[model samples]
Structure formats: structure tokens, C-alpha cells
Target chain A: MPRTRPNLLERQRRRLVVPFLLPALLLYALFMLYPAFTTFYVALTEWNGVSAPEWVGVDNFTRLTDDSLFSSTITNTIVFTVLGALVLFPGAMFFGYVTQRLPLGRLYRFLILAPVALSVTTAALLWKFLADPNFGAVQKVLRAVGLDSLASVELLGRPNTAMLMVVLATVWHGIGLWMMFFAAAAERVPAELKEAATLDGASSFQVFRHVVWPLMWEVTRTLLILWMIQGLQTFAFIIAMTNGGPLRATEVIGTYLYKVAFASSEFGYAAAIAVVLFAAILVLTLLSQRLTRRESEQY
Target chain B: MNRRSLLRATAVATAVMLSLTACITSSDDGDEPETESSGGGDASGAPAEITGDLEVVSFYPEGSPDFERLSGLAEAFEAQHDGVDVTLTFGGGQDVPQIEARWRADDPPDVNYGFLDVTLPDGGPWVAAGDTMNLQPAMEQPLEGYDGTWEEAILPGVRPLISVGDDIYGAPESVTTLQFFYNEAIFDELGIEVPETFDDLIAAADTIKAAGIAPFTVTGTFLPYMQVYWDYLALRHFGLDGLQQAIAGEAELASLPGAQEAAADLEALVADGNFLDGFRGVDFTSAQMSFFQGDAAMILMGSWLIGEMAAAIPADFQTGTFAFPTVDGGSGDQDGLFGGTNAQVVAAKGQNPDAAEAWLQFIADPANQTAYVESTGGISAYTGIPAPEGFEDVTAMLEEGAAFAPSYMGVLALSQEVQTAYQQPIAQLFFGEIDGATMLTQMSEGLQAAAG
Candidate 1:
């Protein structure tokens, strides 16, 4: 049989499809694609965003090696990202499990979700009041008990302590969102599967491990990728709390990028850093997807 | 083609094109008209009646005292000149981020306030590009009751910063200077006199530390405490010209004896644990609270601290400013308190140049200067303007063989990048990890890179 091709009417209909799609495609191209392309292009030019750009080729990227704050920012970002993953992932899973088991699940959900509703800036400011070294409630209670010697300690001044404080703030602020995601995932686990685990006389922990955890791996992995991306972009809290100071101890790559771009007016250098960061994010996401696919295939 | 279908198609196409044209034309209207008026007096030099829209942009936001004063001035100018309308836009913080954004926008503010730097790192030299307007012609002519020449009016040493090669780039409005604000209760309890020399300062620190009180509370987080070290050292070792030369890439940081000595002294201070524990972790508000609560004996900060202290501390707590103590055998002059009067300048492209000039003249007047000083407890920069009554004695003391020295003024004459670069290494020196020699070498390299 000869292959039958589309007749005139069908071919004309196919042509009409492009016109219908053109407006949306044009918008996406203008807003999203253009900026992405321009960011990479600008990365190669020494433009302060003030005057005409001077083409500097790879100078911006080369300068990153010599940049004093580059290593520090990368280290800060990695530390914060790892800590965010470690603390939030396990804690969220546990909270989701507990909330599902609790008698008043609604109350538990509300309590857990309350912090997520607060803005990062507002939360940091509130924490500043709580952690304030001198006049804070914690210090007041300490001083009242003849613990006046501790009154002089600058909790926010010590680099490690400050980093810890930021981690704590971030984890607390982030817990609810991840918990909700995990809780929904765990809730969707088939009732028959859980019943079978129980019928086998599996312990409570055993059921969670064998029945619930396996079912929720996909959701957990998805949340982890999302959190990792967010963690890499973490900046507002540091800016509001520290502005990457105390000797640039809190200067993560995001804040450093902002500084290089806006503060120093080194748009080309900033663009290079931004592109590198974007590429890093893309690679991590793809790796995450690949892992999930492999795990699902095994099942 | 059917006649009716062709007509419908043409109508639809026309409608689409019309909508597109409407969108494009509307955006064109959004382009703010650029105004470039070099305001001048009438032939007789009498005040000219201004009659146009005056556009002003400030880095300071609404409700800040500086913003309030500026806006109030704008309103008053608008009312006085019926034909002039003043439009205001608020922008960036006292940081580089805001300036870059404003500079990049197609419609730059006619009256824009910027840091006293000549150029940004990526932006070519401001003077070379003529990006910034020269204020020399306007600044040269003085208004009535201004009394003194521009040089006579401003603190003598500060002229170098505002004047680039031959032009005045920025008119200083508010000068932020670092001063030692000691807790009176802590000092009194420790039985330590206010320190007059480096030895005295060390001895006082020891006494406070022995008493179990932190000797000093500082926000080293982001080099908050570094300013004191730099300003104090500059006062002792570099002198204004030497500091200026180092900042300009004309002199190497290593060549300056004061830089090494200051760096060494900072290292010593850190090693002795003279600062608040975890000082590097501390932010400004926390460190300030420590000082207010008498947990520390002293804090080094700016004149604006008075406003903060007034809000934070109890009514009865005593707070004051004093000279940074001199180093033993150091060349620093103790009397030179580091700060100067900042002047306000009208941007050349300002729409309401006449109205802007009126506000500038009003603020620069001696009477208004006194009012501004008294209201804010700031020093008067205008010649013949009396210092706020109680502050006169202290002002005279700071003025005695003392010059106004802004911490970053020298670095400012170069570019903002060099200025920000020096802050961190100096901060590292405070951390005691890096020595002064390394810092100086880094500073020279950083400055040279910025120049290139």
C-alpha cells in the first residue's frame, strides 16, 4: 500500500496550529529566553549597567579565580545547603509521620505550617530579638541567675555561632513546607499495603521503613531537589540579618553575586557567576532526576 | 475569496495592528522626559523665578530624617515657586547596588545623590566620560548669609573628596564619623578614666576584662569594628595626604608605616580578646544593645549613634563621644575626630533646577544649618553658624588642631570597588589571621587592579 499523506485541508489545518501558538510562544521567548541569553552574553562583557558595555571576553570568568571572596562564598553556600538538606529532610519526614498519627491532625498541621507563613525577613527580625546577646529574654533570664558573665558573649558575632544561628533560622522557617509535602505523599500510600505490613507482625518502625518510606521515595527526592535549588539561592535572611559581614563569614554565593552585580557594579563578573550558578543548579537537578529514575526502575 | 470574508479578515488584521500600535505608543509615552537645565541667576544675580518640573531622586527613603528634611525642602520650594512641580523618586541604600540600578535606567534622575566616589569599577572614570555633572560653576557662586567662601565653609581637609581634579562631584550633606561611646556606669564602676593614649586604652580594657565585663562590644561581622581601626590609625600614622595618596593608587600600602602599625595594633587588640566574644558574629544592632546594656565598656561608632542610643537606652544613661586614644610614640593626633559636614548637590539634569537650587540654598543658609544641627545634634558645616549650644565646647575641642577625616574618603577618590575591597582584608587583620604586610600587599594589588 502506498503511504497516504495529509490532504489539502489537513495540511492547511496544520499550518493554522502555528498561528494559534505563536502569541504564547512569542511571549515566552521575549520574557524568559531573552533574559537567559542576555545574562550569558553580558557575562562576557564588562558592563557596570551604567554605561555601554565593554567586551571583556573571558576576563570576568578568569577574575573569579583571583577574587578574594569567591572561595569563601562557595564554602558558605555548600555548608548551608548541606545543613539544610540534613536537618530538613529527616525532620520533615518525621514530622509528617507524627502529624498523621496524632489525634488532632488539624491542630498539628496548623502548628507546623505556622512558621512557613511568616516571611523570612520578619522571622529573622523576630529571632534577632530572641537571640539578642544583651537585652534578649534569654540573656535576661541568664543574668538574673548570677550568670552575668555570659551577658557579654556576642552570639551573633562568632562566625560558627552566627552560621549556626542562620542554619537554625532557615531550618525552622523551611520545616513546614517540606513537612506538608511529605505528609501528603505519605497519606497517599495504599491502605492495603500498610495493612499487609501490620498483618506480617512488622513493628511500627518496620512498617514505616518497609511500607511507607519506599512509597514516598519519589516525593522525598523531588522535595530534596526543590530544597537544594532554594538553598543555593538563599540570600534574603543573610542580607536582613548579616549582610554577609563579621568579616564576610556569611557571604554565600547568592549574596556575593548580588554584591558583585549591584554593589560593585561589576555586571559582567556578576553575570559570569550567575551563569555558573545556573549551570550548577541544572546539573544537580538532572543528577537528581537520573537517580530517581534508577531507583524507580529497580522497584 | 468571498467579499464578506475578505472584509472581515481585513477588519481583524486592522484591529490587531491597532492594538499593537496602542501598546507600543503607550510605552513610548512612559519614557520620562529628560531635562538638562544648567540653572543660573538673572543678569543682576537676583533669584530667578523657576517655572518647570523639578525631578529629584535620593538614595534615602521616605520617613528618614534626611529624607524628611529633603522632601520638606522640596515641598516648600514647590509652594514658593507656583509654576514649578517637584517630582521625587527614592532609591538604593547607602550602598553601591542602588547607584548602579539608577545609573543604568534610561531616565537617570536629574537630581541624584551618590556616594562621594568618582567612578564605579566597571564604569570608566566618571570625569573622563562626563557621566557626572561638574558642580564647580554652581558651587562657586554663594548665596546671602552663606558668608564664607566654599573652602572657608567646609572643613578644610574634606575639599579633596568633593573636588575631583578641578570639579566638585558631590556636595557633602551629612558626615558620619566614628566616636567612642563608653558606658558611663561601666567606666565609673571600673574606676577607669576615659583613655587618652593606647596604653591607657589597654589598661582600661584590662580593668574591664578583669571585672568580667566585655572591654568593648563591636560588630566585626562585616568589618563593623574595622572602621574604628582604620580611622584611628589614619589619624595617628597616615595623615590625610598620605592616606589619600595610598587610596589613589599613587602610593603603595606597604610604603605607609601607619598602615603596618595600625594593622599590628588591630591584631594585638584581637589577640588580647579586647573585643566582645564572637565579635565577628555580631551584627550592628546586637553590638549596640550590648553597649546600651552596659555589658561592654565602650563601642566605636558614628555620630548617628546618638539617635540610636536615644531610642535604645534608658533616659538616664550617659553617652558621649571622645577622641580615639593615641598610640604611645605614634604620630596620630588625638584631637582629630574623624568626620566632616556633607553637602547636598543638585543633579545637572534635574527638571526643576531653579526649584532644586532654592532648596539647596535654603539648606545651605546659616540659619537653616543651625536648625538642622540642633534638631539632629549634628555639627554645623556652614561658616558663622553657631554650634548647638551644649555641643560648642566639644566641637571646638574636635576642631583644635584636628581635621575632619572620613574613614573611606581617601579610597573614595579612586573607585567604589577599591574602597569595598580594602574593608575585608582590614577585617581579616582584625581576625588576627593575616598580618599587616599581607594586607598592605593585597591592598596595593587590589587598588592597581581597580585602576586598570
Candidate 2:
């Protein structure tokens, strides 16, 4: 095909591109790309954070085949991400649509978002204290209701209970931000469409399923990807609450790699884990982008 | 855009990333605080006439007594040298990474705490990297504060901690040991004798439990707290050398002599419900709080626990100590001390080696170490110094015939990775989710993988 050369306006625009684009590209490469490439290189070496890095190509990667810990690590990461999506997305969507039509809507919004404002450590610690087996509010409430059996549940010791509490805290701390996105997206879906559907005897559930779902899919996809990325790399909540304990029940890639790097001084192996994490995130993001592809609904 | 313009932009981006990379990573271009020079001449200080700017750094938080003591030492060194200026840097809690970043740039503090397990937390990695100065020559000569050479001044068991081969990397300041700290009121109420052997200890725990109190409490959230349980047991079981060889894979871990009995002893304590409920979830501070609040009768902790928990202790709380109970029929020394030494290290490429050495010499003086022990509420490495007033029990355990051992888990002079692997299975083992044989096998395998 014969290429059409740019005219005066296009040429002038192209001339300004290098100077304007250089700074951002440099920043992106330095902070993002450089570290990423470094991780890939380091993964092939056997380096402690202190000593010189020794090349041990594919050794760190191959260890995943037999590393029982990595299997649990993957399961834990997926549970957090998948469970978080189930709770956060639906809850956010419900609240997003409900609050604007309710009295004291602004107050409700503020209250839900309050957990988000607090630091991650603060929020996790609050949850930990509440779930503390002895004298915590969770046990106190269970006992107050006279359900003694449930009161005996050790919130953090058992594998399932520990992960359950962590996920609950994560959802409580996270949903508010997504709710804001949903509320905004819901607002953009013209009221007349819901009203017409209601007048035609469609149920609220049907209206939401058919109308709101399509309009909000774009935002939802992005949120899901963000949740996946955040979930796979969860470190703070596990470290702060359980420290990957009850015998590695809640270990995730982020926490595991941190232990390998700082605790074991196996920086090279840590870097390898980091590389795999990066690849997983990239694949999931791309897959989500592809699966969510659709024609834009022009409201 | 034309192809040439697009190519040009890519080249520009690459150049920017390349050219500014060094500038971004550089640790210093005059970021260090200007040296607060005392102008050493004619000042009333030591006779040393060293002339240079020295940087001394510590990882202690500002306003901590440790940091204050260090600054005081730095001030004294400045006064003594007359010609040298010393800058003391406090890392607040982020000191290790901050110091390492500097070292990566080939610039580290002139003198620093090595972060030894016995002497300082987070100590070995720097020494393993060969970043610290070797103190052998200095150890050979007489230091003014002690009657003997520097090496002789330090208690015998401590030197091996910071040593790599024949070269010693850190200067020992003080040491500590582990003993049972009992709530005297509780013991008196329950009529429990101070436990002298494993049987007596078990009986004491049973008595305490019968009285509706948790007999013992430990930080389940912190692995080292649980892992420390194995230290005395394994020490008494395999004895010191055997346990060491077992951990190092020189001896068969499974066939170690006292293994079965010690394992039963450990599992029985938990199975009998002798610990606080939900102990595994309780953190260090929480466990200590439980002990302090008198919810638990006793806590197995280090000698430093007193100083660490000083602020939290109640005014009328009567705390008493006894050596960790000896295991009957064990091959190890019955009165072996369970503790480690703490030390300060010098950077290999410090600006003024002589001044750094002089500063350390001043620190090593029996007077300063004595002061450290007094203010820090711990035992000094300097031999002649008397044990701090309340630490007579710890000192008595340090008697000539008594054996000394660092914590098997916490300050074991092993990599944290290997230590963590050994500790991770303890929760399962303690919860009775895994048996003794399984635990030992898992631990050996874990150690191999960690070491690999």
C-alpha cells in the first residue's frame, strides 16, 4: 500500500512529539520497565540481597514444580481475589444504586468509605482485635446471643477461618471506592430507561440485569483487573494479621516472596517469584480485556 | 507522525532513561549532615589526636535510650580525638535498609551496629557481605578501660558470634541469658516451687493450670517465641554439640539421643492445655501483656525481657527468675546458660579507620560497657564488671563451669531462612496436627530446601 505522507499540520504536530513525550516515557521506563527487566534477570541468579548474585538459570523457576508451599500460595491468592470479587462487586453495585435514592445518602456514603480512609495496617489491626478469640467483640457477641459453640471459633488459627476473616476485612476496607465508581456509572444510566422498564412491568432485578449490567461492564472489567492484581500481590493484610501462619494457610505470592527475600536472603529466588507474579498479572489483565470486549453502549 | 520522528522520540526516551539513571541512584552528593565538629584541640578529653571526620550510625529510634547513649559515646569520641569530628546517624527503625543502600553505593557509616542476633538484631548479612572491618589487631592490644587485651576483656563465648573463620567483625558490648520469669504472687498463691528440673517444671505447670490460670504463655504470632521452646529442649536432649551437629546435618536429626522424650515433653504441655487459650494468635505484646496482667503464671523469655517490658510492668508486680529447668538424665550441662552476646561493628571502608578504632576502644573501656549495662539493664561483655543489681541470677549462670548457648531459633547464628523453616512446623507440631517424627522429618527437609 502507498503511504500518504503528512501535510503541514501533521508534520508540525509530529515535530512537537519528542520534547513533550520524552519525560513521561523516561519515567515509565525507569520506574516500571527497568525494575521489571531487573526482576527477570535476577530470577535467573542465586543472589542474597547482600552477596554477589550467582547465575543459576531456571533453578528458581523449576522449584515451583515441587514447592508445596507455592501451591497453597497460589490457592490463597486466588481465593482472596475470587472471593473479593464476589463480595465487593455485587455489594458495591447494590449500595451504589440504593444509596442515591435513600435518605441520608451522603452520610451512608461517608460511613462506607470511612474504612478506606484508614491505613491498611490500622484497618487490619481493627479486624484482628475484633476477631481475637479471647475477649474480642466477635466472641462477645456470639456469647451474648447465647450461641456458645460459635463463640469458641478461633478466628485466626484455623486455615479457613483465618482466610475468611482476612477476606471479610479486605472487602469491608475496599468496597467503598468501587461503590463510588458504580454510583457514578449508575447515575449516567438515564433514569428514564429504568422508569420506562418499570412502567412496562419489569422487576427491579430485571431492570438491573438487562440495563445496568451492560452500561457498567466497562468500569466493572477495570475494577476486576485491579482486584486481581491487588489480590495476587496481597502482603500487608496477611503479614499484619496472620504473618502467613497457622502453618502457611494464608501465604500468598507477595508474602512468600518477601519471606524468601528478606527472611531467607534468597533475593534471586524472590526475583523469580516476582517475575512469575508479573507474568500472571499481565496474562489475567489481557485475558480480562479480551473477554470483556464489546460494543460501547451509547446512552 | 513520520517513521523518522517516531524513531527519534524512542531514541530520546532511551537516552533520558540511560543518562539520568546514575543521578537517581546516587546515595550522596552532599546529603550527609555537615559534621558537628567540636574542634578537638585543647578540649578536656582523651589524649588521642586523630584528625578526620567520622560517621557513626545506629539503627535505634530517636529518643530511645540506646540512641542517646550512642550519641553520648560519639560526643566523647569527638572530645577525645580533638582533631576528629564524629557524626552519629540514627536510622529510627529503617536503619538496616538505609545502611545497606549506602553500602551498595560503596559508602557506609564509619562505625555501625552489625545487627547481630546475640549482640544486635539483623547483624550477619553485612558481615557475610564482608562489608565490616576485621578487629583482630585491635583485639590483640590492650584497651585502656580493661586490665587485659580487648579479646580477653570480652567473655569467652561471645567472640565466635561475629567471627568468620579467624577474623572477628564486631565488638561485643554486652550479653544476656534466658530464664523463667514467674509471677511471684501466683507462685506463692499456688504453692508452686521454683522448677529445678523438667519434672518439677511440668508439675508446676499442672498445679498452675489446676488453679484456673494459664501456666505459660508465648507469642504464637512471632515464630521465634515458639521456636525458642525447642532451644533448651534440644540442647538438653542432644546436648549442645549434638544438637549443633544435627542442625548442621553432621548428625542424624531423627536418631538424636533425647529426641523422643523431649518431643513428648513438648507435646504434652500443649495437649494438657497448659497454655493460654488461642495462644497461637496472640502476638508478642499481647502475650507479654497476658503475663503482666497475671493471666498467665510464667513466661519463658530472655534476660532482656525485663528491660523491654519495663514500661508495661505494674508497680507492685513481684517478678522472680529461675534458670530454665534442667532435663533429668540429659547429657548436656545441667546449668548451661541460654543467651547470646550483642556487638557493634565497624565498616570496612570507613573514612578514618584509626578514628573508628579509637572510638571503639573508648566504647570497650570497662567504664563505658559498665555504663551500657547499667543504663541498658543487661550484662556487659567486659569480664570484670559486676552484674547489674537485679541480674544476679543471670550472672550466676555465667559462672566459669556453666555452658553458654544462643537461642536456637532467634540468635542461633544461622540465616533467618533456615531458622524460619525450622520454626514454621512448630505451630502444627504444637497443635498436635503433626507428630514428632513427622515434625522432625519436615524440619530436616525444610532446612535442606532453605539451605539450597
Give the per-residue lDDT digits (tens) of candidate 1, residues B1-452: 44764786677656655665465347423454444334454223356766777767755577766677667767876786777777767764534455445444434455665534533332234434454556666566656675544444654445554666666666555445667878777788778898888778888899999998888887776453565676576667656666666666677766676777776666666667787765665568778887887778888877767654455677788875566878766665655666654545454434444455565655666666776676666666545666653346445644342456665454433323576556767777767768776776777677666655
Cα lDDT tens digits for candidate 1, A193-242: 88898999999899999889988988887888898899888998887777
- Per-residue lDDT tens digits for candidate 2, residues B327-422, read 888876576667766567766656665667677778878778778777767787667788875567555545342436766534334554466567
lDDT of 2 at B300: 85
Best-performing candidate as measured by lDDT? 2
* lDDT for B139 (candidate 2): 78
| TM-score of each model, paired residue for residue | 0.83, 0.88
Off by over 4 Å in 1: A1-23, A137-154, A295-299, B1-46, B51-75, B83-99, B115-128, B148-158, B183-194, B207-213, B238-264, B267-273, B332-337, B340-343, B389-403, B409-452
Lowest-sum lDDT 10-residue window in model 2 chain A: A257-266
Kindly report which residue stretches of model 2 are placed more than 4 angstroms away from their true locations once superposed.
Answer: A135-137, A140-148, B1-95, B109-111, B115-125, B141-144, B349-376, B396-403, B409-421, B444-452
Using TM-score as the measure, which candidate wins?
2
lDDT value, residue B133 of candidate 2: 67
What digit string (tens of lDDT, one per residue) describes model 2 on residues A81-109?
Answer: 89878888899999998887789987898
